[model samples]
Structure formats: C-alpha cells, structure tokens
Target chain A: MSLDKEKIKHVAKLARISVDEAKVDSLTKDLNSIFKFIEQLNELNTDKVEPLTSILNQSLRSRKDEISDGKIREKILKNSPKKNEEFFVVPKVVE
Target chain B: MSNITNQSLSEILKSIKSKKISSLELTQEYIKNIENAKKLNAFVTTTFDKALENAKKFDNKPNNEQLLSGIPLAVKDLFCTENVKTTAGSNILNNFVPSYESTVTKNLWNNGAFLLGKLNCDEFAMGSSNETSFFGNVINPIGDHLVPGGSSGGSSSALAADLTPATIGTDTGGSIRQPASFTGTVGLKPTYGLCSRWGIVAFASSLDQAGPMTKTVNDCSIMLEAMSGFDDKDSTSINKKKESYSKNLKDNIKGLKIGIPKEYRVDNMPKEIDELWEKGKKILKDLGAQLIDISLPHTKYALPTYYIVAPAEASSNLARYDGVRYGYRSQKGKDLIEMYENTRSEGFGDEVKRRILIGTYVLSSGYYDAYYLKAQKVRQLIKKDFDDSFTKVDAILTPSTPSSAFKIGEKTNDPVSMYLNDIFTVPVNLAGLPALSLPAGLDKQGYPLGLQLIGKALDEQKILNIGYAFEKNCGYKNEIKKWWS
Candidate 1:
C-alpha cells in the first residue's frame, strides 16, 4: 500500500497534473492510506455479484451525432485568455 | 413583507397573478430578505440587477404565463449562470463567470423563473457539510451549530430560513437530500437526465441530477414541471418524451405498495432514526398503503461502490480546471506547465485536493481494473437489488442520512466519516434512480428527520405522489422556523 514518490509522479503524469517534489510525499501518503481502506473490498464475497452502471438498467440515451450545435463563435471566445476573430491561439504545439 | 416566510413558489406566483403584489415588489422583498439573512451565508453572489431587469420583463410581456415569473429562487453556485460568477465554492474558479447559462437555468429562464442569487456550497460540490466552501460556512438556521448539510448547503439553509420561496440544488451522492433532511426542506434528485446537465459544473455526470429544493411537495412539483425538459445539447437528456412532474402530485396513494428494505436496518443504527421509521410505517399503513418487508442484499456494498465510481468520474470531470483554459492561474510559476500545476495546487482547498488525489488513484492505469471497473460492477449489483424490489412495490422507503446533521468540523477531517454521510442515498445514484427527501418528523434531539422515497426510473411522479400523500397524511406542523427567530 505504500505509494512511493515515483508512483505519485507516475499517476500525476497520467492525470496531466505536475506534482511538485515537496508535495509528492504528502500526496503519496494520502493516496496510500486511501488505497489501504479501498483494499477492504477484496475480502467481501463478490464472486456472484454483478457490476452496475445504472440502477434502472437502461441504456444511456444519446442524440444524433451530427454537427448541429449552434454557432456561438463570439460566446465561445468570450472567456478565452487568448483569442482572435476566427479561432483561439495558444503556444504553438509544433514548428 | 418581512414575514413572507414559508410561502411556496405557487403562493408567490399567485400573488403576482392576482395583482396583489407586483413581481418587482416580490423580487425586492426577497432581495431585502437575502440581505437581512446575512448570518446564514446562504448566498455566494446575488444577481441583483439581472433579477430586477428580468422581473421588469415580466411586466412588459403581458401574455407570458410561465409558472415562476416574479418568484425569486436561489441557484446553487454549481450551476452556470450567464454573467454571474460561478464560484463552484472553489477559489480556483473565484473569478470564473460563465459566458453561458446551464440548460436547466436556460429552461427555467425560458419559463420566466427569475434568479435571486448564487448560494454557497462546498468546494466543487465535494463536501456534505458546506464547510469546505471557499465563501465560508453556511450556518444552519436550526441553530445547534449543526452543519447545513452541503455542497447544496446554502440552498437548503436559505429555504429553511425562508430567504427565498425555493432554490435549485443539485444532488450528487446526497448533497441535496442530506442538506434538505438536515434543514427540513423538500429536496429531490430526479432520475438521471431528468434535468439537462449542459451548464451544470460536473461532479459525477452519471449520478448528478438537479431538482427543486422547496418548502412543500406541491412547490417541488411546480418547479420540477418548469425545470424538467429534454435538451438537444445534453446527450444524456431523457428523450422518450417529456412528462409533467406536477401532474400526479394529487394522485391517491391508497393501495400503493411501499417496500421497506430489511438490509437498511443495520445493527445498532441511531435510535432516533430507527424509531422514526417505525412511526412513518404506521402513518403510511393508516393511509391505506401496504408496507411490505423486502431485502436489498447489495446494500452493504453501495457506499464503497459509490466512493469508487463517483471519485473516478469526478477525477475526470475536474481535469478541465487546469489554469490554462479557465479558473485561477498562478502568477508564480516559472513555465507554462508549472503555472498550471502551481495554480491548481494552490487554488484548490485541502479536501478538494484529497478527493482529486483519490480520484486519480482509482482511475489510474495500473489500478483502474481493480478499483474503477470493480466499483462499476458492484454498481450493477446495487441496481439489481432495487430492480428486484421494485417488481413487487411501487417505491422503496429509507432514511435520508444515517442521522441528523453533525456539528461543523465534527468529522470534516475524517474523510471516511464524511463519506459515510451518503451511505443511504448513494445507492440511488449508483442505480440512477430518482429519490426525494420529505420531512417525516423531528428526531428525539428536536432536529428535523427526513424519510426518503426512491422511485423507479422516470417514476418521479410516483415518488412525488407518495411524498404528497405523506405530507397530507401528517397534519405535521413544519416547526423549525422558531430557530431562525
């Protein structure tokens, strides 16, 4: 149940968060304790149990997958940190 | 004007119709009430100009007949309101004002529901005690220093304090119901997708549903009627056909069969709640309803399953808050990535950081199968328990929370103890069932007690009918207003 600093950094990378070296030990300690509590599930007799996504057992409803969203170019850029008339700009990802 | 307390949204709307009071007058009075009830910390930010302007719109549009035109309601800060700062009870989004309103708010606005102000809540709607909110703790009007049960704590306390006729609160796990139970107001978490989620700040998308938090079942019906609708923007919005939530409020519950789950009678439960269940059963029986003992064997795993699934989804849902796109940006970072990390690290509070860490762990690559997948499977077993029971009964009755509201800071540090608060209500979210908390009676300690009636999917009316019947059956006085005095 001991999550090392490396393990914490590993998880943080996958979660897109950058964990500081100083805080890694603290998050590691907390995550390990939580996992320790969570490990209790192995003792339960869940051999015959079926996992569920919804209580009513209905499939999720979905709309037609088409580009029908109303155009809100101005509204979309209203809160953007950096935006031009046609699109949002960020630090260039590639040359 | 000061005593416009305990009036339902229907009563306020009626006064507007009869010309007994202008919508502007009603809005101003509640605005004054919100100002006076400052001790409750119920409001995060008030949309004063927007509300008055909207009320004036009602005056000009004589043909408009929306149910809540002039009536003011406190929107839980979790929902995005255009031009209003949606703090989400987090400092990370301290200055984050949404450019668009959530579909639920949009629908309400289309029907002429005026906004009062944003209510305070736990950070990112994470805690059940409202204490984690960056805006500060919302005091329960119950006055025992009891936490107004949270995330939606502000909405519940405001309703209890009569600051507004009603408030819109979201229930993810038991955020709405626990607070409603603690404060003795009517709150509901409708079947998933009953209200559109396009604008709501995500907690757990699969389980989060918004419904009315009100003073009576009838007001809930009216509010729900206005709020519940299918929206194209929300992929999961119910599409079978829209149903009026208020239509069946007056339906007779005679011969209605209610299932009481034996699994819920855990060993050494709070005596106050256990006794209240017995008394509630007697009341239902006397109303000519049959109470059948039932078993939902999967009840034991519900809490564990909910913790895993909700946190997993929450982990994914919260990823959007990195300082780059929106929310708080740290000024101290040396680089772009460092800036995002440091901003989130400093902006999010301790409890939120803890949950984010747990959420990350559960959904991590090495542990996803063992933790996240297994939790989803247990989720199915939990649903099956209710499905099997509903075959023989119309709805299931259970306690809202394990006990009454705890004193603030009592279990805030103990994460497990805090998670245990949603033990009873979490199962409904796992099953995606609709559940409502209605006032049953006072606990021995004189704090309010809530009885939960869970209904089948799209069976919101059935729960509403049962709640209405319970309210009718008890000439029970809604006594707790004395605390505010």
Candidate 2:
C-alpha cells in the first residue's frame, strides 16, 4: 500500500506534472495514506454489479452531423498562451 | 445595514416587480456590501460596473419575462461567463477569460439575473475547505476564524454575509451542500443532468452538479427553477421540461415516507450534529411524516469510491490544461513534454496536483482495473443501495455535515481529515440524486447546524416540500453580526 518516490514520480510524469524532488517524499506519504484508505473498497462483494456510468440511464443524443459551434476562431484563439494567426504555437515536435 | 440584503429571493423579486424598490437601487446596495466586505475574501472578481449598467437597463423598463431581472447574484468562479474571467479558483486559469457562457448561467441571465461578481472556491472544486483557492481562503461570515466550507465556499460566504442576495455553486461531492451547511444557508445539488454542465469547469464530470445557494429553501427552489433546463449542448441533460418548483412548494409532507439511513451514524460525530438529526426527525414526525429505518450498506465505501471515481474523471477532464492552449504557460521548459510538465506543475496548486497524481496512478496501465474499474463497480452498488431504499421511502434525512464550521487552517495539513467533512453528503452525488442542506438549529456555540434531505432521482419536489415543512419550525436564522471589516 505504500507508494515510493519512484512510483510517485512515474504518476507525476503520466499526469504531465513535475513534482519537486523535496516534495516527492511527502507526496508519496500522502498518496499511500489515501490509497490505504481507499483499500477498504476491496472488502465489498461487488460481483454482479454493473458499472454505473450515467445516473439517468439516458442514451446519448445525436444531432445532424453539421458544424454547430466552430465559427468563432478569433474568440476561441484569444485565450491561447502562444498562438499565430490560426494555430497554437508549441515547441517543434518533428526532429 | 440595509434590510434589503436580509430579505428572501421571493421578497426581492416581488419588490422589484412591484416597483417598490428599483432594481438599480437594490443592485447598488449589494454593490456597496460587496465592496465593503473584502476582508472575507469571498469574491475573486466583482462586476460592479457591469452590474450597475445592467441594473440601469432593467430599471428603465422592467422586464417581466425574466425572473431574475435586476437581481444581483454572485456566480461561483467555476461557471464560465463570456468576456469575464472564470478561473475555477486556480492559478492556471487566472487570466483565462471564457468566450462562451455556461448554460446554467446563461439560463439565469436570460431569466433576468445579473451578476455581482465571480466568487472564490477551492481550486477546480476539489477541497472541502476554501483554503485551497489560489485567491486565498474564504473566511466564514459567521465566525471570523472559521472557514466557509468549499469548493463553493465563496458562494456560501457571500450569501451569509449579505454581500449578494443569492449565489450559484457547483457540487461534485458536497461542494454546494457542505458549504451551505457550514454557512447556515440553503444549497441544493439538483439531480445530475437537471442543470446543464455545459461550460462549468469540469471536476468529475459525472458527479458535478450546479445548484443554488440561497437564504431560504424557497429561494433555492426559485433559483433552481431558473437555472435548470435541458440543453442540447450537454450530452447528459435530461430532455424533460423544467418543473415549476417554486409554485409547487407545498408545506405538506403528511403521510410521506422518510427514511433515516442507519449507515450515516458514524463514530465520534459531534453531539450537536446527532442532536440536530434527532431534532430533524422529530420535526418531520411532528408533520405526520412516516420515518422508517433504512440502510445504505455501501455507505462506508462511498468516500473511497468517490475519491477514485471523481479524481479519475477529473484527471481526464483536466487534461486540456497543457501549455499550448489557454491559461498559464511556463517558460522554464526547453522542450514540448518538459513544457507541459512545467506548465502544469507551475499552474496547479498543491491539492490539485495531488489529486491529478492520484488520478494518474489509479488510471495507469496496471492499476486501472484494480482502482478505476473496481471503483466503478462499487459505484453501481452504492447507487443500487439508494435505488432500493427509495422504493420504501420518499426521501432520506441526515446531518448535512458532521459538525459546524471549523476554524480556518485547522485541517489544512491533513487532507484526509478535510475529506471526511463530506461523508454524509457525497453518497447522494455518487448516486446522482437530488439533495439539499438546510439550517436545522444552532449549536451551543451559536454556529448553525444543518441537516440534509436526500431525494430520489428527479424527486426534488418531495425534498423541497419536506424541507419547507421542516424550515417552518427550525427557527434558524443566519443573522450573525458582521465580524469582518
């Protein structure tokens, strides 16, 4: 049930976050304690239950496959941290 | 102090419509109160200029078409407001001005409600106390040293302090109700899909619900009626017509079956909370309600299951916050992947980062089945418990929170202790049922204690009726003197 620094670091990586080296021990401790607490669910007998995704059991509603929203590119792109005329600027991915 | 702030939502609406009080005057009074109460740290953004302009427009020619016309209300920072900053109480979104409005807030605006400002909350609606907000902790209006329960802490505090007539809050797991309970105000988490979650900041999408935080149950009903309607934008929105809850507020629960879930009795619960439950039961019994002993056996697993399910959903939902898109971007990274990591690490607060990490761990390759899938299955069991119980009882009653408001920074170091504050309230969210917290009585310290009424799916009317009957006798008022300068 104990999470080590390596595991914590791995999770931070997967989550696209960077934890400070000094804080990893404390984060590991917190994660372990939380995992230990949630381990109580292991005691339940949930053999026949189906995973409840949505409470209202409503089927997904579909509409005509036409563009409904993407008309405001200027408004949408205004929030970008780094943007050109029509694209969000990120570091080059291709080598 | 202007008595206008003390009036109920219905009273204010009536006065506005009757021209007894101009919407501009009423709005100005709220603006003054909001301006004067900065010590509470309840508001993250104040739309005073916009509110005044909107009030003038409404006063020129009052519109009966909108229910909230000229009504000054605060929105929790989670809901998106076009051209206004919607931070969701996080530094990542500190400068993020949304282009579109949330459907619920849009519905309110369409019905005549004007915004006082955006209120503070726990970052991404994660924490039990408002301390996790990047804007700083929202102080409880009732007690200077106490915290306004969160992640809708600012909503509750604003209402309690009379800074605004009413406010809107979101509840993923007791975000709305717990804060309402702590502040001695009324907050209802309507049935999931009742209100559109279209533009509200996502935190556990399946569990997040937007509801009203108000001075009275009647106000909560009125506000909810205005805020809820099926939106084609939200995939899960129920296609049913909105119900007129305010018109249907009948104070008669006679012969109605009320269930007292035995599983809610936890060890070391505050004596006042237990007494409040007993008192609540007695009040319902006095109103001729049939109180029955019921059991939700999976109650103990609700918190753990919620921790897994909510964070799992949050982890997925919050993935949109990379450096490339909107919000904060870090300059420390030299490469793309490093940029994403650094941006997220710099943007999100500690509590938010912890949840993201926990979420990532649970949903990781080897642990997905053990954590996420298992939690989903247990979630079904938890829902089944409520489903079976509803067949026998019309509604369930329990203590809203285990105790009244605790002093600020009391449980900041221990996240688990903070999480326990929502023990009695989270099950309803996991099951996607309607629930409300109403002030039941005052504890010995004069702080208010609240009791929750959990209703079956889409059965908000029954819950409101029971709450209405109980409120008549509770005699609780959040008329605490302003301790904050």
Candidate 3:
C-alpha cells in the first residue's frame, strides 16, 4: 500500500499535476500514510453488498432534448484565461 | 445602531417588516462591523456599496411577503455569485467570476437577501480547518489565534462575529457543522438532493450539500426554507413541494424516540465532549423526549470511507480546472500536457494536491476495486446502519466534533489528525441525511462545544424542532468578546 517517489510521480502525471522533485519524497510519505490508513477498509466483508453511487432511490429524471437557451457565447467565453472569437485557446495540441 | 448587528436574522426580519428599521440602515451597520473586524480575515471580498444600493431599493418598495426582505448575508466563497469573484478560497480561481449564479444563492436573492460579501473558506471546501484557504486562515472569534472550524470557517466566524446576521455554507464531510460547532453557531447540512448543486464549486458531487449557518436554530430553519427547492437544472434535485420548515416548526417532542448511538463514543474522547453529550441527553429527557441506546456498527469506518470516496470524486470533478477554461494558467509550460500539469501544480494548495493525488491513485487502473469500489460498498453499509437505527428512533444525537477549535498550525503537518476532526459529522453526509450542530456547552478553556442531531433524509423539520426545543432549555450562550475588533 505504500507509495514510492516514482509511484507518486506516476499518479501526479495521471492527475495532470506536476510534482517537484524536491517535494516528491515528502509527498510520497504523506500519500503512503494516507493509503495505509485507507487500507483499513479491507477489513470489511462486502461480497454481497451493492456499491452505492447515488443516495436517492429514484431514477434520473429526463427532459425533452431541445434547444433551451442560447446566443450568449460572449458570457461563456468571458472567464477563459486565453480565448479567441468563439473558443478557449490552449497550447497547441497537434503538431 | 451599534447593537443592531447583534440581532438574529429572525429578529431583524420582524424589525424590517414593522418598518422600525430600514434595510439601508441595517446594511450600513453591518458594513461598519465588517470594516472594523478585518483582522479576523473572515471576508475574501466585501460588497458594501452594492449591498447598500440593494437595501435602498428594498426600502423604496418594502415587501413584507418575502422571506429575507433585503437582509444582507455573507456566504462562503464556495458558492458562485453572478459577476462576483467566487474563489472557493483557492488561488486557481482567484480571478474567475461566474457568468451565472448558483441555484442556492439565486434562491436567497429572490427572497430578498443581498450579498454583503463572499466569505473565506477551506480551498474547494476541502479542509477541516480554515488553514488550507489560499486567501488565508480565518481566526475564530471565540478566542485570539484559535482556528475557525472550516470549509465554512468564514461563514461561522462572520456569523459569530456578528458581521453577517446569517450566512450559508456547504458541507461535504464536516465543512458546515464542524465549523458551526467550533464557533458556537448553528449549521445544518440538509438531505443531499434537497438543495440543488447547480453553481457550487464542485468538490465531491455526491456528498456536497448547501445549508445555513446562523446564530440560532430558528434562523437556521428560516434560511434553509429559503435556500432549498427542486431545480430542473440539477438532475439530482428532488422534485417535491417545498415544506414550510419555519412556519411548521413546533418544539413539542413529547414521547419522541431519540437515539444515542453507542459507536459515537470513540476512545480517548475528551472528558468535556462526553459530558456535553450526557448533558444533551439529560436535557432532551427533561423535555419529555425518550432517549434510547442504538448501534451504528459501521461508524468506525466512516472517516476512512470518506477519505477514499470524497477524494476520488474530487479528482474527477476538479479535472475540469485544466488551464484553458478560466482559472490560473502557468507560464512555464511548453506544450498542452505540460501546461495542464504546471497550471494545476502552481495553482492548487498542498492539501488539494494531496487529495487529487490520492484520488488519482485510487481510481487508477489497478487499484479501483481495492480502494474506490470497496469504499462505495462500505458507504452502503454505513448508510444501512443509519437506516436500521432510524426505524427504532426518530433521530440520533452525537457530538458535532471530537474536540473544540484547535489553535492555528496545530495539526497542519498531520493530515490524518486533521481528517479525524470530522469523525462524527462525516457519516451523515455519506448517508445523505440531514444533521444540525448547535452549541450545547463549552470546554474548560471557554471554547464552545456542539451537539448534533441526525435526521432521516428530507426530514429537516423533525431535527429543526428537536434543535429548537434543545436551544430553549440548554441555557448555553456564546460569550464571544469582540477581541479582534
């Protein structure tokens, strides 16, 4: 259950968060302790138990799939860190 | 005018309705108090001018039929306020302003409550203490340098400081109730689907719920009535007619069965908290309510289960914060992948990063079954424990927090110790049930302690009535001296 520095780096990469090399050791230690504590769940016998997702008993309600509201593209793009006429600008995805 | 801020939301509503005090005058008084009490760091952004304008508007056309009727409230920064800077106490969203309002805050404004300011909170409503907020730590008004119990730390601190007559906070894990318990205020986390999660800054989607933080239990009822309803925008919102919690609030609980769960008496619990629970039981007994011993067998596993489930969901929800959409962007990255990594690392605080990492690891390819899926199954068992207990008793009683507010920097290095603060409060969120924390007694250090009443899903009225009766007979008053001012 313990996380080493490499495993910490791997997980951080998967999570899209960068881990500094100097801080990775401490991060590994903290993650190891947390996972060790989380390992306590293994004591329970949940073979027949259902994995509860939503607490409500009813099914998800549906709505008519139609145009509800639109034409406010400026408001949608207002908060973007970098945006052009109609879309958010990210670093070049395709070389 | 000087003592106008001391009145509860319910009391102030009556004054406004009777035209004894204009809304503009009340707004000015709260503005002065907030200005004088800046040292507590309760507010992240103050909207004094806008609030005054709205109050004046209310005065020109006084509406007595509305619930809030021009009362100014300071809500936790976790809620999205349209065109207002809603940071969720994180640097990542330090500059992001929402184009739309959160459904809960929108409901408040529709009822005549105006925004005084956005209050500080644990980043993404993550921490048990206010220490993790990127804005800074909110000092508890109870004593100098004491931490306000958080995610709703700013809400509780502001309410106790009388900066805001009432406030709202979100609870995921122990965000609202723990802070309310620490600051000697009232906080309730309603049934999960009761309040729509439309515009809230997502932490854990399934567990996050918005509720009221106020000076009295009665105020909690009034604010909860205004804040909750069915919303078509939120798929999980319960589509039922709204119940009038404030109007139907009756304190008569004669012969009602209240359960005292045996599992809540954790080992090495401080002597005073246990005594406070005993005193709460005695008071309920004297009020003609029957107290019974009950068992919630999976209680011990609640905190561990929460750690797994909340982080797993948080990781998925927070993935939306990648650099391009509207938050902090890192200048160091060369490519798209590096941009996301650098933006997140530079923007998020250590605790948030830690949770995200834990979530990523647990939901990764190999470990899903062992950690994430297992925790979900364990969550069902935890909910079953409450369901079994509710069949025997009308509601359950427990201490809100294991201990009173700790000093700043006390448990920052020890994440496990910090997570343990929500021991009694986390199970209710896991079960999607309603719970309330009201100050019942104080520790030897004069710090306030709270007793929580756990209710069945959508049964907020039952717990509100129980809390109402308890508030009348408890005789515990919060003696918070305005030391920061």
Off by over 4 Å in 1: A2-6, A16-33, A45-66, A69-73, A81-95, B62-64, B481-485
Docking class of 1: acceptable
TM-score of each: 0.93, 0.99, 0.99
Question: Whose lDDT is greatest here?
Answer: 3
Point out the higher-scoring one by DockQ: 1 or 3: 3
Q: What is candidate 2's lDDT per residue for B203-254, written digit by digit as tens?
A: 9989999999998889888898999999999999999977999899999889
Runs off by more than 4 Å, candidate 2: none
The superposed Cα distance between candidate 2 and the true structure at residue B135, in angstroms, equals 0.7
TM-score computed on alpha carbons, candidate 2: 0.99
What tens-digit string does per-residue lDDT give for candidate 2 at A20-81?
Answer: 99898778888888888899999977778787777877789989999766668888789999
lDDT to native, each model: 0.81, 0.91, 0.94
User: Isolated chain A: TM-score per model?
Assistant: 0.83, 0.89, 0.92
Question: Over the stretch B1-485, how does candidate 1's per-residue lDDT look in tens digits?
Answer: 44555577777777778777777777888887778788888888998898888778777663347667667677899999988889999998898888888988877777777788999999989998999999999998887488999879999998888788888889889998999999888999989878888889998888888988999898998888888888877778877676666765765788999999988887667998998888778878888889999999878778777777777888889888876557776766566566667777778887787777677888776888788878877777778788899999998889888888889889865777787788788888888889999888887777888999999988988889888988887655566654443
Off by over 4 Å in 3: none
